[model samples]
Target chain A: MEAIILQILNGLDKGSAYALIALGLTLIFGTLGVVNFAHGALFMIGAFCAVTLQRLLNLSHEVIDDTKKDFLGNPLKVDVPYLADWFGADAAQTIIQWSVPLAILFSIPIMILVGISMERGLIKHFYKRPHADQILVTFGLAIVLQEIIKAFFGANPIPTPAPPAFTGSFDFGALIGMENIIYPYWRMVYFAFAMVVIAGVFAFLQFTTFGMVVRAGMADRETVGMLGINIDRRFTIMFAIAACVAGLAGVMYTPINSPNYHMGMDFLVISFVVVVVGGMGSLPGAVLAGFVLGILEAFASMNEVIDIVPGINQIIIYLVAIIVLLTRPRGLMGRKGVMEE
Target chain B: MLGLATKDFVLLLVVAVLCLFAPVLLNPFPETSDLAQFNAGYPDLMQRFVIFGIFAIGFNILFGLTGYLSFGHAAFLGVGSYSVVWMFKLLNYNIVPGLLLSLVVSGLFALAIGYVSLRRSGIYFSILTLAFAQMSFALAYSVLTPITNGETGLQVYGNDPQYLQGDSAPNIPHLFGMTMRATETVEFGPWLWQFNAGYYFCAVVMLIAFYLAIRIFRSPFGMMLRAVKSNQQRMRYTGLNPRPYTLAAFVISGMYAGLAGGLMASMDPLAGAERMQWTASGEVVLMTILGGTGTLIGPVLGAGLIKYLENILSKINDNILHQWFAFMPDGLEDFLVAIVHPFIGKGWHLTLGLVFMAVVIFLPGGLVEGGQRIGRLFGRKKPAEAEAKAAAKTPAE
Candidate 1:
């Protein structure tokens, strides 16, 4: 029972990431009908936002004491960060605690601009081309984005600490009657934050007239156009929203997995698999499938199962995807006529 | 007509001669000059040009002729490399068994993957192939680490158990009693050029592969493939099964990929999971598409161009650009060098992207069409030439 609960928690955090990425992917697929392979890169850019903000906030004023020297004749110096000087010494040292969450505001505009530019500049031309061309072009875009980031950031993962207040684990052993049942506070925070974002996105889509129009456009773009609506403009906005969502996910993910240029690639494959398993263009299905796969992945990685199959944990997701694909061609919530000729 | 035939034959002969003497032809500066590194007209680059040409040619057969874009072809190439390395480790360093095993294993693997993936079409087909490729990559990295040697890649030590060659085998096996790397260098004036045995061996194989490709291009099977690409539904209505033909094409391409992989392993003696990544698979697609997918000779040109640019552009760092602009004023030189610096050296991808976009926009029929367009612009030629050029310019039905 304890193990199952623990696995569920593990699953939820991972599922949150997958769900967020897949949701964005589905949104792009739904609204624009363009499979944005560069969505992962957008997510990566978001994580980099946190890294950048931390670096920017940590920039310090160096004070060199020419009168002081070490045994090796090195100069002694004291550096004071701008944040520390402004807020206080204690506050300046703990700026990462604030800057990480603040990155959401910093990343949103940049991500939106990137999303808009990408849609208008490159993907706009590829819309009429074959799906293969769209994939190739977007894939090329993804590579370009990743390589540019890599050139700037180098290949190393930069660790982003959560705010000092949310840095520990919550011990659930007392309530559970188990010796140890500890869950990381940051992970719990991540789950709740994901829920809030997911709720916000769902509410924006469900309640607004914009969502209805976009959904209608998704069903039939020609009919929407016939209704004297500019579906393309709405689609571009949705793509930007999707980029923001991915960016937010990336921003929050930095504390869990240190931000790196290649992190997008690692998540992109799994998120793509998640999208496929959830059924292409199905938003709600993407969310459900992400959590399900995450839990299953958690379970597969357990010692007992791993001891039997060695690397079953890594292969299990693909095996499951293949099985799901073979059994349910349209996926769990896949609509009819989507894959139909 | 005799004159036309002679011209065509001479054109091909000239290209062959140019490739054969590329080291001499590409050497712009004398060896006695201070800039020796710039004159890197070595065997490695030459071998790479031919090897990637083979890869792209094989990829073009399936993608260009059949109009089936595979996103997992590199898995076969990686499999070929791994198989060859294993052969060297377990059997002997002899190239024959390794190459043969590479072809067989990769062909069989492709047969399995294609059998399932070909059931779908368009985006689904691409996704299916991509999934399998990722699976292969992941398995090689983690699950099959014993076979693949994980991230460090599979390699062979000198003290490997050679069952076939026994105690008589040399450290590096010979081809018909000829050393693979044995070469004679001749110095003429200020330039030194080497005629490498390995390069010639690869060149012979490449020529054979090219001949085979040309035969396939003109065969009845080739016509059927074109018909399938034109209208699969119509082909089905006519009681013709496109499945078997597509499968055959897939297998043949896989074999070609395996051959390329085997040659790579033979040249470098190592294999890694990175070779099986989707990026590598995508590269062959770029080569085929950029060069001219359906055209017989387009892929070779595309492959050679991409590989050559990768080698040259990667070596042109900021310092090299600065050196070129040294004659200008200090500020102006710095600005000029900085402007050109990003497009080369780590930023070569930006150039590649621009080229890809240009190709997709203007020359959809590829470099072949570009060539014909240039030819037409030069002035009036033979009526047959004009007509042939017109037909080539038209996108495949």
Candidate 2:
């Protein structure tokens, strides 16, 4: 029971990331009718935004301190962060500690601009082109984006810590009357944050007029356009919103997995599988399948499972996708004619 | 001659001659010249040029002729390499049996994968193949470590039992008694040319492959494959089952890829899971597209161009860049070097991506189309009329 609970908790954090990215992918697919291979790059860019903000906040100036001795026994040149001097050292320390969350605010405008520019510059010309062309161009774009990031950040994974308060693991075993079932506090925070974001998106689509039109446009673009609605403009905004969601998910994911240039590509293929399994162009389906696959993946990686079938975890998701695709070609929640051809 | 049309016969003769004398043709620069670095006459690189040429040609058969874009074809290549290595480990270090086993194994693998993946067409087919390949790669990397030797790659060891090997048999891969690494260098004046047995062997195989590809391109079977690509629904309605034709193309192409893989192993005698990665698969696709999808010579050109860039262009470092720009003013030279720095050496991928994007966007027909456009600009021939004549020549219903 304890192991099962622990696995479920472990699954949720990863599932949250999958759901967020899959949600964004499905959004772009649904609205733009595009297979955006660069969606994962957006998630990567978001994570880098957090890294950049952390680096920026911690920018240091050299100070010679006579009290501190260097390795050679001379006066030590201590590098003190400018933040420590500008704000009182305590406030600056707090700000630095909360850099990951602060990156959310920093990444939003930047992500939106990126989304808008991508839509306008490259993808705009590809709308009327073949799906193969779109995929190829976006794939090229993904590579260029990642290579650019690699140029700036180097190839190594950069560790980004969460706030001090959420760094410790919680004694979930005591709460549930099971010993030795500890879960990280930040993971729980990530889960709650994912829920809020998911709820917020769902609410935005359900309660707002703009989202209603966008949803309507998704269902029937031509008819919406016939009703004199500027569906294209609204869809562009929807694209930006999707980018923001992916970005936010990436920003929070830094503490879970260190930000690396290739992290987006690693997730890209898996998220694509999630999108396919969830049924293409289905938002709720994307979310549902994301969690389902995440849990399945977590279980597959268990030692008992590995003992039965070694390396099953590496391939279980793809196996499931193949089976699902072969058996139920439309995916879990896919519409009849969506990418059937 | 050889049952080919006059034009095709000429093309074949030209290609054969090119392959036969590539050492001299590819090495235009003298050994002592400043431009000597541009020469691609080395045995290793020449072997790769032909080997990857074979790979891209096979890929073009499936992708160009049938319009079925496979994203996992490299898995077959990897399978071929592994089979050949296993053959070398168990049997003698002869390439003939190794190559044959690789073709057979990879063909069987392709048959199974194609049977499932071909059930879906278009983007779905691509994704399905990708999934299968990724699964194969993942399995090879982890659970099959005993066979694949995990990250260190599969290699031969001294303890391996070679039942067919005699005490005097050479350790390196060979044809009968002739070693693959055997090379003869001929120097005349300032020019140095090397002829390697392995390169000649690969070049002969490539010529045969290219000839087979040409025969297939003009065959009724090729026409059917093209019909499937152009309109599968119409072909189905006309009482032709496109499935078998597509499956056959997939398998044939898979065998070609396997052959290439076997040749690779025969040259190096090692196999790694990275050969089966999706990126390697994408590299083949890039080669096919960059050269021209449906053209006979395009894939080979694409393969050669990409291999050249990867091997030669990536070798250009900052020091080379500075040296080349030394004639400029100090500030201008520094600026030029800085601008050129990121697109070479370790940054070659960025340049490749940019070039790929440009080709996809502007030259959708690939480098062949660009050539055709230039040809038309020079008033060599009326392209539309020539296309019509070519279409009329083909016995398409």
Candidate 3:
């Protein structure tokens, strides 16, 4: 029972990432009718935003300390961060410590701008083109974006630590009347964060008049346009919103896995599998499948399962995707005629 | 000539001449020239050009004709390589049997994948194929390590069973007694050219593959495949089954990829799981689109262009950039070199991405359309009519 609960907990964090990325992907596909291959690149840009903020806060100038000798027997050149000089050492240190959370604010505007420009500049022209062309163009865009990141950052994963307050594990065994059921605090925080974000997105779409019109537009764009609604403008805003969600997910995920240039690509194909399994344009299904597959993957990775079938964990998600696709052609919640042909 | 149309005969002859004298044609620079680094006439690169040309040509047959965008074709290539390596391990060092086995194995693999994937059309089909390929790649990297040799790749050893081998059996892959790596260099004046046995062997195979692709393009079966691409519903209403034709095209292309893979293994005698990655599959797709999808010879051109760029452009470092801009003023030279530095060498992918985007957006017919447009610009024909014709020819969907 404890193992099951632990596996579920383990699955939740990975599922959160998959859900967030798939949400963005489905949103773009739902609203703009585009398969944005560069969506992963946007998520990558979000993680880098946190890295950028962290680096910015830690911008240091050299200070010679006569008390400490260097390795070469000279006076030690202790680097004092500019933030420490300006805001006093304690406050600047605290701010730098909380850079990951702070990056949410930093990434929002940047991600929106990127989303808007991507929609306006390159993807706008491709709206009428074939899906193949869209995929090709966006794939090209993805390569360019990833290569640009690689050039700037080099190809290494930069570790970004979480705040000291959330570094350790929480012993849930005592509360649950079970032994050794400890879970990491940051992972629980991530799960809570994901829940809030998912709920917020659903509430926004359900409650707002703007969202109602957008939903109507998704169902029938031409009819909504005939009723004189500016659906295109709303859809573009939705695209930006989707980009924000993906960016926020990336920002928060840096503490879990160190941010790297190719990290987006690592997530991209799997997220694509998640999207397909969830049914092409179904948002709820995307979230549902994400968690389900995540748990399935966790279970598959267990020693017992590996003993039964070696290397099942490496291919479990894809195997599930294939089986699901073959059996359920429209996916779990997909509407007919959306990419059915 | 050879029962082909006049245009096709001329094209074949041109291609033949080009392949036969590629060493001389590809190496225009003198032996000691500074531009020698740019020459791609060496055996390794030349072999790659034809091998990848074969791969791309096969991909074009399926994608250009059917408009079914497969993202798992490289799996077949990997399968071919693995099968050939196994043949080399178990049998003698002869390439013929290994190549044949590669075709059979990959063809069977393709048949299985295509049968299932072809059930769904459009993007779903693409996803299905991608899943299969990813699964295959994962297996090859992990549990199948006994067969695939995992990250180190599958290679031959001295103790491996070679039942057909004699006392003097060559360790390297060969056709009869001739080694695949055998090369002869000839010098004319200041120019030097290398003639490689492996390259010629691959070039001949590439020509044959190209010829088969041309025949397929002109055949009635090809027309049926195109019809399926244009409108499957209409074809179904006309009482024609599109599945068989599509499956056949898929298998044929898979065999071609397998052949290319076998050739690759024959040249290097190793098989790595990385060859089956989706990125490698994307490379072939990029080659086809960049070269011009539907046109004959376009895929080969695309393959050669990409391979040449990959080999030559990647060798240009910061020093090379600085050297090129040394004639400028100090500040200007530094600025120019710095600006040009990132998009070369390690940053070649960025340049390639930008080029690919430009091709897809501006010239949907790829380089062929661009060339046609330029040709029309020089001629007396009105540009508007030519533009319309070109637009009409392109399958927009």
Candidate 4:
């Protein structure tokens, strides 16, 4: 029972990411009607923003320390970072420790700019084109973006540590009267952070006037346009919001599984599957499917199943997708007339 | 009209003769020369020109004609490859059974996929196909590892039960009695040209495929596909269901991919999951689009151009750039070479991307349109002006 609960906990952070990305994808599809294949790349760019911030914070002037050479080293450099100079050594360490969360403030504006430019510059032209053309062009853009990232950052995964305060795990076995059951603190922190973000998004969408208007536009863009609501502008803003959401998810995800150029590619296909299984243009469906699939995947990875059927872990999610698609076609909450051609 | 067509046919025959003896005709130049590179009658490159030509030609039947873009056609190809490999593993190395099995298996898979995928049109269809393809890929990588051999792929084992033939002869796949890579090299001056047996076999198959494609293009079924492309609702209202025709086209295209896959494995005898990735499917689409989608011969040219460039561009390096730059004034040459260097060698994809963008933006009808434009430009005036003049001459009637 404890093991199952621990597995469920382990699945939540991943589930949160899947939900966040699928939510954004569905949001864009529901409103703009563009597939937005570059969403994954946008997520990647968001993580890189955190990496960029960390790099910027650590920028230093190198000084030769002749006295510090030891154990076959030629020379030692005692560097002083700009952050250390500005905030003093201990405070700079702390600031750098919390730089990932701090990056949200920095990444939001940058991602928004990127999102707006992407929509206005490239995607705007493709809106009237066939879905195949849209998919091809966006796929091309994704390849270009990934290659650019590779050229700059190389192919290796870069590790980003959580803050020093959240580096340990908490014992849950004692609480449950079981031995040797513990959950990582960072994971729990990740779950709370995800909830906060999700709640904030929900609140913004459900309560705010802008959110209400956006929802209204999603339901009937023609009516919104007829009302002189500038539906296009709101749709563009929604694209930015979607991009930022994916980006923020990436930023938070860095500590869980190091960031790399092709990390987005690894997730892109599965996320698309998630979106399809959820329902192409349904937000709540995406959220539900994400958690359900995440838990299913966790269970599938367990030792008991592999003994019965080898390599089930790799295929369980896809098998689930196929079954759902065959039965539901529109997915769990899909409405008619969306992809009916 | 008969006289004009006869004249064109004779001209075509003469061009074909020239193409057959191209290596001998262009022997004055080194094989590595740009002109020779274009004209070289090497069997390997020629084989590829035909094989991928067949693949793209088949793809255009479904995508270009029917406007149903499948992003998972490579799954059929992978299935074909695996089937052929399995045939080689179990039975004699004769390509007859392997090829037959490839076609049958891929066709069946396509039938299943098309049935479900055709249920949803547009993006939904595309996503469904993608999901199925990924499912196949995952299964091949993990669950079906015993059959596919997972990441390392399948290799030939000499000792096996000869299912059909008696003992003393080993059961291994072969084309009659000849080796797949059997080739004869001819030397002239400093150039060496190879005439590979397997390549000629592929060439013959490609010609047959081309002929079949032409037949399909002119058939009544092809007309129905075009109608479906124009407006499916109109077709449906006319008491004609487009599903069977589209599904047939899908299956035929899948068979073509399977044949290509079988040929690949026959030549190399390895099957892997990587070939079934979405990227491979996209590549065929790219080739079809780059050459000319709706045209019969355009896809062949597109496949040849991309494959040739892929092979050649990967060979360029900084040393090659430096050598070319050595003829100019030292500083000036270095600067110019530096500017061009990044776009070559390991950066071939950057050049390919720019070319793709150019093709998409300008030559939307692909190389076929580009050819017609050039022909018109030289014949009388600018192509656009000539087109206007032709439009005036023809009238609506």
Best by DockQ: 3
For model 1, how does the per-residue alpha-carbon lDDT over A169-272 read when each residue is reduced to its tens digit?
A: 88866776885679888888888988898888889888899988988899999999999999999999999999999999999999999998878878887888
- Every candidate's lDDT: 0.81, 0.90, 0.90, 0.78
Q: Indicate the docking level reached by candidate 3.
A: high
- List the candidate 1 regions with Cα displacement exceeding 4 Å: A63-77, A173-175, A339-341, B1-15, B33-40, B166-168, B381-397
- The root-mean-square deviation over C-alpha atoms between each candidate and the true structure, in angstroms, is 3.3, 2.5, 2.5, 4.2
Q: In model 3, how large is the Cα lDDT of residue A105?
A: 95
Over A190-255, each residue of candidate 4 has an lDDT whose tens digit, in order, gives 778777777777788899999999989988889989998898998899899888898988888888
Give model 4's docking category. Answer: acceptable
TM-score of chain A of 4: 0.95
Global fold similarity of model 3 (TM-score): 0.97
Q: Assess the local accuracy of residue B241 in candidate 2 as a C-alpha lDDT between 0 and 100.
A: 100
lDDT of 4 at A219: 84
Please report how far candidate 2 places residue A73 from its true position, in Å.
5.9
Tens-digit lDDT track of model 3 for B1-397: 6766666666776788999999999999897988888888889999999999999999998999999999999999999999999999999889999999999999999999999999988888888888899999999999999999999999999899888987786779998878999999998999889999999999999999988887888788989989989999999999999999999999999999999999999999999999999999999999999888877777888899999999888999988878878888999999988888889998999999999999998988787777677766777655334432333344333
lDDT of 2 at B300: 86
Q: Over the stretch A234-301, how does candidate 2's per-residue lDDT look in tens digits?
A: 98998899999999999999999999998998888889889999999899999999998988888898
User: What TM-score, computed on C-alpha atoms, does each candidate reach?
Assistant: 0.92, 0.96, 0.97, 0.89
The candidates' DockQ values read 0.46, 0.78, 0.88, 0.49
